[model samples]
Target: MAEMFSMLGTWNWLVLGLLLMGLELLAPGVFLFWLGLAALLVGLLSFALSLSWQLQILMFALFAVAAVPLWRRVARRNSGASQSNPFLNKRSDALVGRVFTLEKPIVDGAGTVRIDDTIWRVAGPDAPAGSRVRIVRADGASLTVAAD
Candidate 1:
């Protein structure tokens, strides 16, 4: 172990650290990130101070274990910052309670409506083209509507 440390250089640690960080891009979820960061920190420290393999390993382990929780705490605190708009991804849901004219006649609870340039399929009572309807909610890709 001592011989291995004697032979290993800070450059090796740096290379290993970079490789691990790169690997995190392929398999991501906050796992490799901490370890890779630990390796890089150890590498930097090694350059400033000569360290035995045991101390190096200890530092790496401490960094790995300690950093993640601290990061998670800060992350948890910051995440509470005005959550992303709830309506951002719910395109259909955003249309609920709004009124629009039908572009096609609804027959047996099926029809289409044009809002802007996009055509949306609607489910509601039978109505002729040009009839106004109010969106109730979204069901999958279709909207549930009622006569306005």
Candidate 2:
């Protein structure tokens, strides 16, 4: 093992990099790709300057660890620029504060309202049909409303 490491050359690093990168395809995580990149960088540098096996290993470790935060910073920057839908899969919560006319009269603190073709059950003070009410809270399919 010691002899093999001592005999490490530019081609060895490049091959190791390629092998690691290929393994990334099998185990689909973004980890091995960075180590592969580190190995490739050391291999490229080895062409210009002969590096001891220990120095090459150190450089590879440094590059691999450094890549994590660098990648995260770039990923965070790109993510911040993208628009995310907060209301995705949460249809009822999106209606909070929106005013809609009651389709059925509220008696005994229960009523129904039609909003965009969907009739929603509401709870609030008694109100006659056609009266406007604002959605104050949402709990699952039920809405708490107030006269608008």
Candidate 3:
């Protein structure tokens, strides 16, 4: 184990980095990808000069410090991209501003509506079944509604 650690070369480190990056495609998370980049930088440094163990460790620390924050920024931007996609996982909020007809009358502040083949619980002013309603807001899985 010690010998393997000591004998690691620039190409070997580069290969390990590529492997980690490939694994990130399957994992789809930010962590391994940055560490892989850090390892690749270490490999490039190793190829450029003969470094002592302490120097190698220091270089890795610096790479991590530089890469992690940059990776986090990119990940944050990518995650924010989903907010612009209308069909993303937002259930109730997606329903607001959409129109639906009540499948069952709203009596005592509760009823059901068929919205695109899905029945959802609704809260609004009393109305008979088949009346048009517009979703005003959403609370969890339920929608607050008003007459259309």
Candidate 4:
């Protein structure tokens, strides 16, 4: 292993980088890709400067660590720009502003509404049963409503 490290060349780093990147396709968690990127950087750098194998390994380690913060910044920026759906897993949030009829009368600011075979607890001003109400807000399993 020491001899191998001592004999490290640009091609070796490049091949190792490519192999790591290829492995990422088989067992991916966005980890190996960074290491691959670091190796690739070291390989490319070796073309311009003569670095010892130990220095190359050190540069690879530095690049790999640096990639984490870079990746986080890029990911955060991209994620904020466009989101697929704001209400993907939050079903209650999607119900806001939708109008539904109250199945039970809202007495003392409490009532129940049935929406798509699911009974939802509602809180709002007193209203009679069968009255149409618009969802003003959703808090977990409870919804705040207003007479529509």
List TM-score per model, in order: 0.85, 0.56, 0.66, 0.60
- Which stretches of model 1 miss by more than 4 angstroms? 74-82
Per-residue lDDT of candidate 4, residues 13-125 (tens digit): 89989999999999998889999999999999998899999999999999999999988888898887556777877999999999999999999999999999899999999
Q: Count clashing residue pairs per candidate.
A: 0, 0, 0, 0
Candidate 2: tens digits of C-alpha lDDT, residues 72-111:
9978987765447677779899999999999999999999
Clashing pairs in 3: none
For candidate 1, lDDT tens digit of each residue in 57-104? 888889989988987997898777636666766788889999999999
Q: Once model 4 is optimally superposed onto the true structure by TM-score, how far is the C-alpha of residue 61 displaced, in angstroms?
A: 1.4
Please name the candidate that would achieve the greatest TM-score relative to the true structure: 1
Q: What tens-digit string does per-residue lDDT give for candidate 3 at 35-134?
A: 7888899899898999865676677778878987797788799988887886587777878898988999999999999877688999999999999999
| Candidate 4 or 1, higher lDDT | 4
Residue pairs clashing in model 2 are none
Clashes of 2: 0
**Candidate 1 has what TM-score?**
0.85
Each model's lDDT: 0.88, 0.93, 0.86, 0.95
Error of 3 at 95 (Å): 2.8
What are the clashing pairs of model 1?
A: none
| lDDT: the better of candidates 2 and 3 | 2
